[model samples]
Target: MSGRILIVDDDPVQRRLLEEAVTRFGYSSRVVENGVEALQVLRAPEGGDIDLVILDLVMPELDGYAVLEKMRGDGNSTPVIVQTAQAGIDTVVGAMRAGAQDFVVKPIGPERLEVSIRNVLKVSALEDEIVRFRKSAAGTLTFSDIITRSPSMERVIRLGERAASSHIPILIEGESGVGKELIARAIQGQSDRAAKPFVTVNCGAIPENLVESILFGHEKGAFTGAVDKHVGKFQEAHGGTLFLDEVGELPLDVQVKLLRALQEGEIDPVGARRPQKIDFRLISATNRRLMDLVKEGRFREDLYYRLNVFPIWIPPLRDRLEDIPELTRHFLARFAAEEHKSKVSTVAPETVALLQSYDWPGNIRQLENAVFRAVVLCDDTCLRPDDFPQVQANCASRGAGGGQGGEPRIDAPLIAGEPAIRPDDAAGERSGEHAGAAALWKAQGSFAGFTDGSVPFGFLRALDRNGHVQTLECVERDMIVTAIDHYGGRMAEVARRLGIGRSTLYRKLKDYGLEASNGQDAAE
Candidate 1:
C-alpha cells in the first residue's frame, strides 16, 4: 500500500515543494536535480524504492523524454507524470506518446499535484491487482494433470499444449462437463504470458443485459448499476489471457462487441468517449456446437470464425473410455488429498472396469464426482465395488455384470431403458441360438439393436461402423444410475455427488424412472 514517488526536476524550489506535498500524502519522495540523476537512481538497486516518477520535460542533460524512452526500452513500467512550464496540447501529446502517464502545467498547485499522483497511483494499483489476479487464477489450473491414455484424449492434450504456448485465440468445443475450461487453463500454463493474468468468465452466467459491460467494462454512469467505473475482462486480462467459457451462450449483441474487441485490439467501455487499447489473448469454450449454432442462426458466423482461429475439440468421456482408469485414479488422489485422508488409496479392478464401462454423460466432471463420492464413502484403503454403488447399479442394470465375478444373471436393467433387458419370449428364442452367432451379430450392431429387434440391425451397424454410435440419452442414463448406486439409494447423496441439488436429482430420477425401486429389499 505504501508507494515511493521520485521527483525529477532541475528547479530546486519545485522539487522541494513537490517532495513536501508528496510526503504530506503519506508517500515517501526522493528528489533528483535532473533526468540524469533520476535515471541513475532507477538503474541503481540501492538508490531508492521509486514507484512513480514526476519528471520535468525540459532538463539540461538526458531530458525527461529521453529518460522515459530509455526506461520503457529497458522494459521498466514505473508510472511517469510529466510536469513542465512550457505546456501545450502538442507537449502533452508528446509526453504521453513518450510513455508518460499524465501531464501537468509547471505552476502546479499542491492540491492538483497530489490529485494527479493519487490518480496515477490508483491506476497503477489496479494494474497490479490485475496481474496478481491472473497469476493466482492461472496457478489454480491443473488440467494437464488430467491423466488419460486414450488416443482421442491424448490428441486433445497435445492440442491444449500447443494452444497454451501461443497467444492465439483458442476455442474448445465439447459436451458439457467435458473439461473445456481445463483445456483452456492448460493452454494458459503453456503460454509465454503464463506469469501474467489468466482470467475466466462464464459467458452464460452473466445476464445478457450486463454481459457487454462485463466483457468490455463500463464507464461510470454507463447504465443503471454503473455507480462506479468497472474494469471489464479485457482490461483485467491485459498482458495475459481471458477465457470465455460457454461463449456460445453469449447473446448476439454482446458477440458483436466481443468480435470488435478481438479484431480491433481496443474496447469502448460503455458510455466512454474513447476506446482504450488492450493487449490480451482470448480463449473461449462451449459445450454447444458453435459451428452448428452459427449455421442455425443462433450464433454469429463472424464471431465464430474469429474465435475459431484455433479450435480444440475435447472428446467426450465415452469416446475416451481407455482414460477412465487413469482419470479415476487422479480424481481419487485429488479428493483424498483435499479431504486430508491419505489412507484412502487404490480402487478395485472391478470398480475400475465398472467406471470404464460407464458412458460419462457429464464427461470428466461426472467422473470427478464419482471418484469424490467413492473417496468419501470408502473407509478402507482399497475402493470396493460397493464404494461406487451407483456405478455398480448402472452396470448391473445394463446387464454388463457388475464386479469381477459376474453374479447370477439378474434380468433387472442396470438403468431404465437399457437395451439389455428383453421380453421373456425374446430371451427364450435367443437361448436356442448359437452364442457365437449372437455375439457376432450383437457386436456388429449398436447396443440399442441388441434388445428389441425393432431397432434395425443394418442401420445400427452402419452407425457403429461409422463410429457415430453413442446416444446422449444412453450416456445420461448411465450417469444417473452411477450416481444413484454411489449414494446407496440416498437421493441426497446422489445429488451431492453429481454436483446438483437434491431436488434437481429427484426430478431427473423421476423423469428417467430411476426412482422405481424393486420393493424386495426395504430395510436391508
Candidate 2:
C-alpha cells in the first residue's frame, strides 16, 4: 500500500535523511525546512492526502508542537509521529496530550520508525472508516424512553444523548438494578449507529474458562469443544456497539486481551493465524469501583484509564425516589397487562407512600419485581397496602428502628428458630462485597413466612384499615380470598402467592368459610 509522508525539520541534513527513509519505505514524501512551511503545505486542500507526518520538535518559525496543536485544534486528526532527540517520559506524554499519535527519539531506528508509522496509520484508517460508515441521521429511540420526573434522570438522558453522537467508549457506573444496561441501550439507540448491532455480554455470568473464546472467538478444533468456527464479540459488533456489563468481574487475563483489542482496534481469535480489524464503539458497566480493583492490583491500571474515557454514573433508586411514582405506574401498566391482571392498573396513594418509605436496597429492579408481585397479588382495580405486605413491613421496621440483613422487617423479629431465607439466598446470589451491595431481583414469597406459623409481614394491619384498624385474621383471611380471586380459584397459584401449601390453602378456605366462594364447596 503506497501513501504520502510529510517530513518537517529545520536541519537540511535531517530533513533529507527523513525524506529518504520515508521514500525507501515505499511512500511518496514531502520535505520542508521548518514547521511553518510544513503547516502551509499541510493546510492546502491537497494536504488531506498526507497519510503520516514525521515532525521534529525544535524547528524554527513554529515548532512541531505548535503545528500539532493547531492541526488538532482545527479538528485535523491526521496521524503524526513526533521525532525528538529527547524522548523523556514527559515529552512523550505531552506530545500525546497535544494529539500526536506517537513519538520517536533522535537518530531513529528504521524498524522502530516504520512500526510506529504503521500502527498510527492503521488506527487512523480504522477511524476514517468509522467516520465514513457513520450514519447521517440519529435514530428515533433517543433518550425519550428513560421515564423520569426527577432532574437527575433528565440530566442523565441529556448527557446520554450527547454521548450517542460520537464513537467514544463509555463507562457506566451504578449499583445493581439501577438500569446501567438500559442507559447503555438508550445511548446506542439514540446514536447514528443505532441500526447496527448492540451486542451485550455479562462478564460475571460467563465461566472463567470460556471468557477468552467468548470475547475473541475460536477457530474450529482450537479447543476440546471447538467443533465449529465461531466469531467473537468484537468481530460480531463490527460497525456497531459492544456492551460489557459487570465488567469488573473480567479475569485479569481476559482484561489484558480486552485492553489490546480496544487499543489496537483488532482481535486475534483463538488459533487464528492473524488478527482481524474491527470497528465498534464500546460501553462498559460495573457496579463496583474499578479504580479500587486497580489499586488492589486485580485490574490493569492502563486498561482502567482506557475504559474510563467517558464516565456516566447512574444514581441508585434510593437517591431518586421522586421518580418512583412514574416508574411504578409504568411498570404497573406494563406488568398488569403482561401478567393478565388488567384490572390492577393504578397504584393507590398509600401504597406509593409505603414504597417511598423503605430504603429500596435492591434498587429499581427490586422495585420492579415488587410491583410485578403486587400486580399478581392484586384482584382489585387499584393496588392497596394488602397487595404489598413486605413493603409495609419494611416501612414499619424502618420506622421503628433499622435492622440487620434484608427485608420482611416489621414491629418484631421472627422467632429465634424459624426457617427463613435471606432475600439474596432465595435468588441464589451471594452478597457482593466487592460489588458495592449489588442486589438482584428477589421473587416475592421466595423467602416464605416463618416456620412457626406466621403470615408474611404480619404487621400490615397496624398501618392499613377500612376506616379502622383491622385484626390480623381479617388481613390474613382477606389475602387468601384475593389470591383465590386473582388466580381464578387455582389452589396452586393461590398457595404459592400466600406462601402456604395447597392443603394449607384448603384449610384456610374452610377456616375462612370461603370454600364455596372460590369453587371448592364440592371438595369441602
Candidate 3:
C-alpha cells in the first residue's frame, strides 16, 4: 500500500482499470504497454526498487510467464501477481511455478485485488521482521557479530552454546584463520561468569624461560627478573575464563605444571613454598593436532584428556565459500566508514567473481584485509579489480607459475555478471588487460572513448606500450561478443555490469551478429 505498483498489460482499457485500482489502494502506479516494455522498465536501476508488479497474462514479444521466468532466473525476488482472463487451474499453477506470489482472474474486482495486494505486502513485512529478529537473536545468543549461514558454522555455534553453560574445559581445533578465538570468546561471553575478566594467552609467543612464571605467576625475588611480584594469565583469569591459544606449543615441562593445575585447582609460584588456589574455566585452541603432539610426548596425556571435554572444530573459509558475498558486504560497510569512502564501498560483480575464484589460504581474516586494502585504493564510487592490486598481482604470479590444463590466466579481463573470456581470447581480454574490463566495458564501446574519458595512467601506458589501436564500431562489437562469451550470454547481467541499458546492450548484441552462447549470429 505504501509502494509503487507496476501495471503491465497490452489493453489500454485494462491497463487504465488496473492503474486506477492500484492508485485507489493508496499506492502510486506505472503503466507499461506490454510485457517486453515491462522487463525494460524493471531492469532499469530504478526497477530494482519496485514493490510489486501486476502482469497481464497475454502480451506480444514476451508474456507475463516469460517475464516471471526471466526475472526469477536473474535472482530477482520481486513479488508479482499474475492477472489472466482465463481462470484455468493450470495457468495459476504455472504462474506459481514461475514465482508469481498470486494470480487474479480478469474483469478485476477492486476488493479482490486489494485483498491480495494487502496479504502479499503483509507477508513481505512479516518476513523482513522475522529476519531482523533472527539477527538480533543470533547476536545475543553467540555474543558475536560473526555473520554466516553456513550449515557447518551453524552446528559449531550450537555446540559452542551448549559448551558455554558447563564447567568443562573446551578444546577448539581448526586452522589459524578459521576463527577459533571467536568461538572461545563467544563461549566466555555467554557463560555464567560473563561479568568476570576473560584472559587470553598465546603459548607459542611466550619465551621458553618464562613459561611457568607467565602461566602460574611468581613471588617477588622468584628469579633474576623477580624484583616485584608478577600476576600470571591464569591468576588474572581467576573466577572467569582463560583462553590458551596455540596450547599445543606449551613446552613439555610446562605441560606437567598445567596438568597439575587442572588436576588440582591450584598453581605453585616460582620460589614459593605454598601453591595458590584458583578457579577458572579453561578454553584451549590450537591449529595443530594435539593428539599427535601427545603421542610425541610434547603434551601430557592427562592434560589432553582434561582439556578435551568439549571439542569444537571451526570450518575453514574454503569449506564455506558460499558465505563470502555476505561477509564481503558486511566488511565493505565497516571498512567504508573506516576509510571514509562511502561511494567506493560497494563492489562490482567482477570483484566478487575474482574474490570467489581465489583459494583464500588465509581465510576470513585475509579476505577482510584484502577488502580493506581494496577500499583504501578504490578511486571511484564502486570497487573494481584494479583497486585490488595485491590480489591481481598474486593471481598473476600464480598464472606465471604454470598451472594444470594450461598457463594460469593472471590478468584475464572479467566482465561483471559474466563467465569470463579467457586471457588469450581476442574478444575482450586483451583490450582490458591493463585498464580492466570494468573500464573498457564501461566505455560507449570503444578503446578511444575508454582512454579519452580519463587517463587512468595504467591502462593508457599499457595500451601505448602494447601498440593496440582500434576503431569505434569494432570496440562495441567485440565488447558485446566478448561479454556474451564471458557471461555465457546472460544479457540481463551483462547489461547491468556493462553499465548500459538492457535494450541498448541487446541492440549492440544484434548489431554485432552475436548474442547466443551456441555461437550463432544474432542478426540471423
- Model 1 scores worst on lDDT over the 10 consecutive residues at 422-431
Number of backbone collisions per candidate: 13, 0, 4
Query: What's the TM-score of every candidate structure?
Result: 0.51, 0.53, 0.52
Residues 165-214 of candidate 3 have per-residue lDDT tens digits of: 89888999987667887787778768787657778898866766788999
lDDT by residue for model 2 over 1-524, one digit each (tens)?
23568888888888888887776655568888887788888889768667788889887779988999988887777789999999689999999988888888989888787667655654554454344234312323446556565668877888888899888889999877898987887888888888788789988667668889999999999988899999998888898889999787787888888999899998989999999999989999987788877887767899999999989998888788877876776677667656877545556567777787756766888888888888898988677888887777556655655432333434344433333322221210123221211111111122333234344432222223234455778767755654444344555435544544354566777888886655742331
Preferred candidate (TM-score higher): 1 or 3: 3
In model 2, the Cα lDDT at residue 418 comes to 30
Residue pairs with clashing backbones, model 2: none
CA lDDT, candidate 3, residue 356:
71
lDDT of 1 by residue, 282-359 (tens): 988876677777876768999989999999888888898867765665566567767876666556666777778766
CA lDDT of each prediction against the hidden true structure: 0.69, 0.71, 0.71
Q: For residue 134, what is the lDDT in candidate 3?
A: 58
Number of the top lDDT candidate: 2
lDDT of 3: 0.71
Q: Mark the regions of model 2 whose C-alpha exceeds 4 Å error after superposition.
A: 1-140, 404-524
